[model samples]
Target: AQTVTQSQPEMSVQEAETVTLSCTYDTSESDYYLFWYKQPPSRQMILVIRQEAYKQQNATENRFSVNFQKAAKSFSLKISDSQLGDAAMYFCAYRPGGGGADGLTFGKGTHLIIQP
Candidate 1:
């Protein structure tokens, strides 16, 4: 079984600043995928970035990047130059690499607040 944990229930950052959301997972599978997803007020789950456990490099999409520590089983999201649009609920998710019928396992989520 795999589980994802978000230590922070809520986080706040000033506009144009940076914020990091922490996530950790426990999994027995050797190959898996880690992801950060964002849900705005619209309730849409948007993929922010993804990292493969076999890959050494972190995944980045524009100002959104991940710090993936495979050995530590830690995957955190870094949002740089945070904007108003970035204010939302962020969720860390995991999926097996083998691709199964089971859906992604998600964290409890962290609500990000952008302070102007």
Candidate 2:
């Protein structure tokens, strides 16, 4: 069983600042994948970053990066130079390795508020 937890239900950041959202998970599988997704007001889930269990290096995309602590079962997302457009609901998701390629299991979400 895999469960994702987003302790903070809401967060705020000023434009051009940096913000980091925390995530923790419990999973029995030793190998799996983790992802961070952003959903703006439009309500579309966009992949922000992904980390593979076998990889030692954390994944990075543009201004988004992840701090993946495999043993601790924690994967956090960091947004640098946050923009007004970045304000949205962010979800941390997990996909278990093998077994029919398990689909994503997402966290409830964290509402990101951006102050101009």
Q: Write the per-residue lDDT of candidate 2 for residues 5-74, one digit (tens) a residue.
A: 9999999999999999999999988889999999987877898889999999999999999999988989
Regions more than 4 Å wrong, model 2: none
Residue 9 alpha-carbon offset, candidate 2, angstroms: 0.5
lDDT of 1 at 17: 98
Q: What RMSD value applies to candidate 2?
A: 0.9
lDDT of 2 at 15: 94
Per-residue lDDT of 7-116 in model 1, one digit per residue for the tens? 99999999999999999999998989998999998998999899989999988899999999988999999999999999999999999988665589999999999999
Could you tell me how far off, in angstroms, the CA of residue 104 lies in candidate 1 after the best superposition?
0.1
Candidate 1 — which residues are off by over 4 angstroms? none
Q: Candidate 2: global Cα-lDDT?
A: 0.93
What would the TM-score be for candidate 1 when compared with the true structure? 0.96
C-alpha positional error of residue 101 in candidate 1 after TM-score superposition, expressed in Å: 2.8
In model 1, where is the ten-residue run with the lowest total lDDT?
95-104
Best-fitting candidate, measured by lDDT? 1
